[model samples]
Target: MARKISAPSLFQLGYYWEAKIFLTSVKLDLYTPLAKGPKTAKNLAGLIEADTDALTRLLDALVSIGLLRREGDAYANIPELAEFLAKTSRFYMGELMLLQDAEWDHWGKLEDIIKTGKPTVQDNIFMNTPELGATVSKVLHRMAKRVAPALAEKIDLSDYKTLIDVGGGGGAFTIAFCQRYPHIKASLFDLPQTLKVAQENIAQAQLNHRIELIEGNFNTGPLPGTYDVVFASDILHYQTEAENAALVKRLYDATEPGGFIIIKDMFIDDDENEPGWNAVFSIHMMVYSEKGRCFQGKKIRDWMTQAGFDNIVEIEKNTILAGTKGV
Candidate 1:
């Protein structure tokens, strides 16, 4: 008898249904209301102003998907959903989910992008819309908060006094570092409109007095000032290889002697293949940016070495790189 191979992987291709269900639930503000307590589908429909029959089915789907729990006719959020999906939770991910909902339009044109090698939507749409920018900034800030404590623990910043966050959209990492080391004052550099969002976040973190906001484009102009530490997260993938090399050189010159420059972004293998998530993100960069793509860790290391940085260290499974400036 011949061995048989299964094709259950084909079902993964239809995973968009799961995404749509979750996005729809978020758009309906379902989880937030459920955060209050369990409610029957009919009661939830009345509260969220939806048709009871339709909502019942949707609620059942949510329960099946493990985003919500069902007891008889009552539907309630699971613990994970209650914490991260509920709008009342500080870690709410609804804004990012909503942004992904908007990106569905661009993702729908993947075929056009593949054929023409051109983006169907404007790349700077977020920057052009204040509301969208703020939403994205808030989401990014929350994400940074989630990762910052572990990151701060990994890297020693005791000796560092001043820091600059290049293209630091909402000052999440800045606030985190400052909170971890109360003696460290930081500067956040970003676009004027982006800085507005960062200012609000920084003020909320109560680091307004410690974190100064600098409004400018690092690509077009010089960085604000020299610092003991320079950090850039999720920003380098927006530039070309040559541009990144140039930017690294500029950052090198701006780094104080014996200081550190840290970069955190999704990086692909040297072959630019494998790591399914990074490969998909490379495609996303192709559609969203003219010159951006997921760069290789080796190339980033080369850039840092060429810029006179030594003691380069790869951390977080190569998602982050830190280089030391020689004294």
Candidate 2:
């Protein structure tokens, strides 16, 4: 008989360990200082306001988790981690760490949520107020500004002139695309408060002339007239299957013939266990938003087809579904 297999506990322990590291590193801005150059423990101790011994331990822990790299007795931030995790970098995930912490706080009470079949997050925290919701929405847009631009180049946006970025946080995709393809004019649509930040971000990028900012809830509000492409990044996962289908159909109607729609979000593989991010993201969606859940690309493809889109293909692009509308 074949030997019984077992999963490793290292990963579970590592998860908690990494959580601590991420929390602390973001708190101390460790990556930013070291991003300037490798620094000795003494320097970091002063910067973090901790004792040499405690700082050394924290640095070692971060190094062990691969968030930091040690050179001899000094420490340096890993390039990728420095760029994305450091507070000083444009791609900083520090605020996102706080958002993740907020989500995990709700996850701590998941047992009760499961028992009552009730939603949490915005209910227990954030006061369920429109203003607070707007604040969190801006934070999310800031997050999009940090993470989405890096992935922008991975897709081909050269062909389209007018594009609509649905739920575009901070208008990052539009900023990046405008910088790359000077001819591609873009529009961003989101909640009013969120659009406020998106407009500022676009202006800061000095691309205000290239992009338009519109405020409206995609589900209930009227979409702007036809465009060459409608791109939904980190937007669709927050809706139910039926709602996503409806929105896809709506996007199809709003798109001119031969135009395309892009749906980008996390997805699970058919086997259900592959690509670990999908599994974690599913739980995250449950804790964070109502009717949100990570899904499979195949199911999404079906939804696209049902919504009357053609040329549906899961290209080598980032976790996105791109398809064209037939005349």
Candidate 3:
């Protein structure tokens, strides 16, 4: 059963005051200057060109939220957060925050989108801004490095000879798989611009000779070569169910005899209302995408069955849908 919310909790849920405060600070870049040393609100206002009186309240609010620390006359970024929040920090995640800031405007139209069933933005961030897409690709690569290793650990790829990562961004999973299994030669296929990031990442990993980078759109593709394993991760959410079904059929067709078809995505349960994150993400898609939304695991299971797959199984419940081609 789901937990019931109290009055205060419900109020807090409706209140986005603190979220806006943090995103606003990210936009202001207040952490960068504070990383050098603490500053009074007046000093910060002068640096970022914010109004002194208004900036003081925001800084105090940041302190209350534990993002900032205030003492005597100055405020500073919390030590742990400064590592990622500060613009000058090597581990900075300001880009991701900036991305949320960009979406802030779109999310405001959630009501209108719900009523009209129209997307707020014409194109996703990648299509509208190539430069930002490249930076986000790098950020995502760094994050996926932490996750792909675990996923690699889950799936046994020791016997798989050739693998294609359909819509693989920046070669994160491909790199992890190649590193885990020495005999595996892989293909990293994605859009032309996204593949540039993949090329740089593959070269850095020194697997350039082993992993061939293919530049094309997966939606309009005759993917090159049959493979022992065809893995699609985090790409299905961008397209419609029919599109994804067609994609799955294509992947199944491209699979070698006795090969595996793996699809990894944030999937909802049959109800599509139980998983909170995916439920919210459904609305996110409604606001941002023309034909994107979270799907049920059953949808993939049906697609797999329809595509003439055998030995179908969801290896990670809703997160990973896997099936084997009959020998």
Candidate 4:
């Protein structure tokens, strides 16, 4: 059923108090110390060099939100969340939250942007700050460990011999694709700085020979070479519709006949109200990017069709699409 609402619920929706508190905890690395053992607010404050009373209030608030547990005066990190929140854990996802914490100030310009039809930032994170962008990409890679492998399961790449991962930050998708399809050679393409980080990842995966690192911006020129599969994952949302369409068209051009082009991105419903995540993400894009916005699926499919792709299918609803370049 569609989300039902009441007056109180509507009011609750406006509250971002819990979100900010949670983000604050992640930013402060509070969970790391708590992971060692339960600690009093004073102990935590002394370690972090913050006021004891204020840290107590914040810790109590975290208890209220179920992220921490309190017994008397000591607070403990929730066992399950510690896997993701503890700095020593292999699965720590603090970096992604740090990125959000960094961008919190840009959201302050939302009202002014809405009124003036302008953005707070000149470019998206990837283009404006490559170092931070590379780190954030690695964080996302760890957070969604199954994303690319799952995509590999969905798409049939058995016959394809080569692939190009456009804007392939950290080479996550390329790594997954090559791992799943051993016969295929892959190219991971992105800015030079991002490729350096990807190089380290590829080496760690021991796939340096199977995956080639190609350094170039996809937006500045045509992709370096044609391939059996041109896969641009999680990249289109950072551009205007015109740029997205043009990129899709280029993907079609680079795709060899009898092969495919795939774009994986958040596509909002035409009514612009459901899949609540993408809807709100569109607003985030508008505030943080000069032209980025979540787009409608059919609009992008139409561009693919216009570019002469045949047998197009939406492999996942409003998320991924695969189009064939007819022989």
Q: Which candidate ranks first by TM-score, i.e. highest?
A: 4
Clashing pairs in 2: none
**How many clashes (backbone N, Cα, C below 3 Å) per candidate?**
0, 0, 0, 0
Question: For model 4, what is the alpha-carbon lDDT of residue 242?
Answer: 82
lDDT of 2 by residue, 1-327 (tens): 223345686567546767866786777778878878999999988887878988888888888878888898899988976877777787665766766665656778778877987677442122255565555666666666665666567677778788888888667777877787788988888777677777777888898888998877788745888888888877766778888888888888878898888888887765654544676687777787766777778878888898888998775433778899987
- Worst 10-residue stretch by lDDT in candidate 4? 269-278
TM-score of every model versus the real structure = 0.89, 0.75, 0.94, 0.96
TM-score of 4: 0.96
Candidate 3: worst-modelled 10 consecutive residues by lDDT: 271-280
Query: What lDDT does candidate 3 reach at residue 225?
Result: 83
lDDT of 3 by residue, 1-327 (tens): 345789999988899898899999999999999999999999999999999999999998999999999878999878899999997887888888888787888888988988987787665556667678788788888788888988988999988999999988889999999999889999988877788999999999999988999887777766888999999998888778999899998998889999998999888877644664676677777776677788888888899899989888878877898999998
- What candidate 2 gets wrong by more than 4 Å, as runs, is 1-11, 14-18, 28-85, 114-116, 122-160, 273-276
CA RMSD, predictions in order: 3.5, 4.8, 1.8, 1.5
lDDT of 4 by residue, 231-267 (tens): 9888888998888778888888889988899988888
After best superposition, candidate 3 residue 188: deviation in angstroms?
0.6
